[model samples]
Target chain A: MVIQDLKVLICDDSMFARKKMNMTISALGINEVFEAADGEEAVAKYKENKPDVVFMDIIMPRITGIEALKQIIEFDPDAKVVMASSVGTQGHLKEALRAGAADFLQKPISDEDTRAILENAAKGVL
Target chain B: MFAQFFGGYLLHKKLVTSEDLTQAFEDKKHTRMRLGVLAINAGLMTADQVEHVNITQQSVDKRFGDLAVELGYVTEEQVDKLLSQQPTEYLLLGQTLVNNGVLSNAQFEQAINDYKTDNELTDSDLEGSKNESLNKLVTEFYHLEEASNARMLTDYVTMMFKNIIRFIDGDFTPLEAIVIREFDAETLIEQRITGTYDAVTCITAEKDVYFEFAKRFAGENFGDITGFENETVGEFLNVVNGLFAVNQSNEGGAELTMTPQQFIQDKKISFEKPAFCIPVVFSFGEVDFIVSTE
Candidate 1:
């Protein structure tokens, strides 16, 4: 899929974070973008839409990004979920990867980082 | 980080008033670092030598750096090194204060020397963002060593200042911290860190000041929205705590997690343990950060 054809879902409890990333993803010419304020909504959105890529924040209410990632993977084993978190500790990194995250990005994530991830997703490389 | 703390020290010493600092911070962006101040900061020339160079330059058409070299005060190579180095923020602040006559050159020299000697900081430490130097500055400035969790407190406060510089405004003066068990907050965002240890962190400020602080992080579009200021400030605290937790995990193998931030307005909250309430004054107003290790 080309970058313009990609659909993205952003899951973050912070309205500021979600709004910032949503603007970034939309700016990349991807018309379809989804947002969730918490992990429960993230899982529900994932199962409902199955976007091309998911940007998941680790610390959230209701459930964590890791738990949400596991649930999404159980529903679709080939899900492209990138764990975007401020806490990129070795423990969280190992746990996220073990739970089948496609990749991890540390915060505060830059615009270039988001663009690069979307490019990789479009190329089927994530 | 060093610049903010150095300003705090100057305020604590009463060398400069808060109004003087606020003005200097505003003007420092356009202030150029003079060669004499740079030389004095480098220890290559004393304040008297710098005065002599300034007086000599008034008579001769030669530049200050050239005259200093001709007078054997500093070598041409040293002058080049001093000029080539990008001026640090604290030095810019000092230069601005001097330009505005808030501080004399001699007073600036004495203040810089005493600041370094008192903090046991070297010139390199002041120029760079080294962790050890910063930890020492935070611990000594806040008297965090007296706390029960000195190491943890030092690490947390150091991380807090770094993020304040990173995400928020760097033009803030970190005031002295007070020990508090309870605080009546106008508007406060609270987040609890739990796991191997438990601690509470909070950010509180008045409505206008809180809105301005949030605007710095969330940009202008989200500024006037009702209830968004609390979310923006809460996210700032959340990001800082997340990074602190990650640092603790990486360096000390302490796994930590933070609960969703809670916003409380016009309420009284008390901590089970004493917390350090650090009041930092920005261009807008004062904001207090409270951290309690429970």
Candidate 2:
């Protein structure tokens, strides 16, 4: 799989976060991108799109990213949902990994970090 | 960070108006640090001595450092040491103010000295940005030592400024904080930290200033996106509160979690306790950050 062929879903309540990440991923030459404003939409979108990778924020209005991650993994055990959040405390980190998150990134994610994640996903390593 | 607090100090002392600060912050980017300003900041030369050197340099081709040494104002070693040092942000701001004539060299000397002495900041403290010194500065600036949960308030405000500098612009002046029980907010986002202790944090601003702040954080013109201004501001509050929670959990053995942020517009919100409303003036406008530890 090449980087441009990857399908990515971004789940964040903030339109700012989603739009910023979308621009960066699009700049990476990946055209297939999906967005969700909360965890409910995230799970629905994940099941509908079955994106190659998901960037999920921990806090959202309806359901949290962690709960949505669990639902996605339950729907498809191989779902790649990375916890991209502000709170990367020990408890959140341990719980995210326990819920089978592929990776965890602290908030204020740089464009470089996004690129690295996509590269890993393309190589089947994320 | 010291630069920002120094700006705040200047504002508090009435040594410089907010307009002076705004202009100086803008002008500092192009202002080069001269040996005269550095020597005065280092206390090795008086403002009059630096003025004399400036006058003498107009007639002679000698550099400021050589003339200062030759005039017995500063020794050769002191001149070399001052010139060898890198210019910190605060020094650059001071130099800009001096150049702009907003502050006389004497006023700059007095303000810098008093700022250091009042905060009990050593030269190393100003240069190195040690956390202990920052905590002291925050506590002193807000008069948090007399407030309930002083330590927690100090820690939170200190971290807030750090994040503001990290994510937003560093060219902001933090106004003196005031304790308030109620506020009629034009635009506001509130989040709660709960667990071993409870606290509420909020950011509020006028509509235009709110949009400007959201624009700064989002790094885009939000004109096309409907409801983007509120969401961007809410996310900033979320990020700051989340980091504060993580810090508490890791260092203090206090497990904390944040409630989803709530956005309110043109509403009256009252805190159960007296919240410290810290108004920070950016080049764009003033935004108030309110925190109450319950």
Candidate 3:
């Protein structure tokens, strides 16, 4: 799949975080980008859109990102969900990886990091 | 980060007025660090010597370096070393103040020396941005020693300022902190850090200042983002608190987690413990950051 053809889902509670990531991903020429403001919405959106990549945040209003990741992985074992969170502690890292997260990005995620993740997903390497 | 705290120090000492700092921070972007300012900061030449060199340069065509050497204000090797060094932000701020006539070279010299001595900071400390030096500076600036959780408060405030410089504008002065239990907030966003310890962190400002603070964080991406002022400000608080939590988890082996941030309007909020209200005056206006650790 071409990079631009890869569908992306960004799950973060902060409107600002969602908008910023949406803008950055859009700038990478990825035309299909979806956003979910919470972990529950993230799972629903993942099932609905079947996006190629999911950038998830740990802290949110409803279900935490780790639980969301678990639900998504249970639904589709091949899902590529990256734990993009502010709390990337050793405990969180171990839990996220154990929950089948493809990767973990500490926030304030730079545009370059987002772009590289998308490129890797397009190449089936994430 | 040192530049911002140094500005705050000068404000506390009455060496420079708030207006002086605002103008200097604005002007410092274009102000090149000159040899005289460097020499004065390095303690190799007094402001009087720099003024004397200026006077001598008016009569002769020689450069300030040659004249300084001829006048025995600084050695040729010292001049070379000063010129060879990269200008730090604090020195640039000082140089800008000197150029703008807000501070005499002598005043800059005295303030810089006093700030370093009072904080027990060395040139390398300011240059390299050593974490220990910053912790000391933050603790002393806010008088966090009197607080119950002095170490945590110092670490959190230090991280807050670093993030402010990183994400927001560095052109702000952190005013001294006041411990208060109650605050009538015009606009406020609060987040709780819960795990092992419970703490509340908040950012509050008047309507206009709140908007400006939000704008700084949102930047050019959210120009048409109507009614997102609350979200923008809340995200800033969230980011700072999140980074602080991560730092604590990594260094101290303390497991910390942040709750989703909430926005409040025209409300009165009280803390279980006395919260430190740190008012930082940005060029746009002042915003208060409150943190309570229990």
Best-performing candidate as measured by lDDT:
1
Report the lDDT tens digits of candidate 3 across residue range B1-294.
999898999899998899999999999999998999999888899889999999999999999999999988788999999999999999999998888887888888889999999988998999988889899999989889988899999999999999999889999999999999999988999999999788999999999888888888888658567768888888888888888988999899989898888888898989988999999999998999999998
Q: Report the CAPRI category for model 1.
A: medium
The CA lDDT of each predicted structure is: 0.92, 0.91, 0.91
Model 2, span A1-126: residue lDDT tens: 999999999999888889989999999999999999999999999999999999999988899999999999999999999999988788888999999999998877899999999999999999
Ranking under DockQ, best-scoring first? 3, 2, 1
Task: Give, for candidate 3 chain B, the lowest lDDT window spanning 10 residues.
Answer: B219-228
- TM-score of candidate 2 relative to the true fold: 0.96
Better of 1 and 2 by lDDT: 1
Candidate with the larger DockQ of 2 and 3: 3
Winner on TM-score between 1 and 2 is: 2
Off by over 4 Å in 2: B58-61
DockQ of 3: 0.77
Give the winner by TM-score: 1 or 3: 3
Per-residue error at B206 for model 3, in Å? 1.4
DockQ of each: 0.66, 0.67, 0.77
Q: TM-score of the second chain in each model?
A: 0.97, 0.97, 0.97
Per-prediction tally of clashes:
0, 0, 0
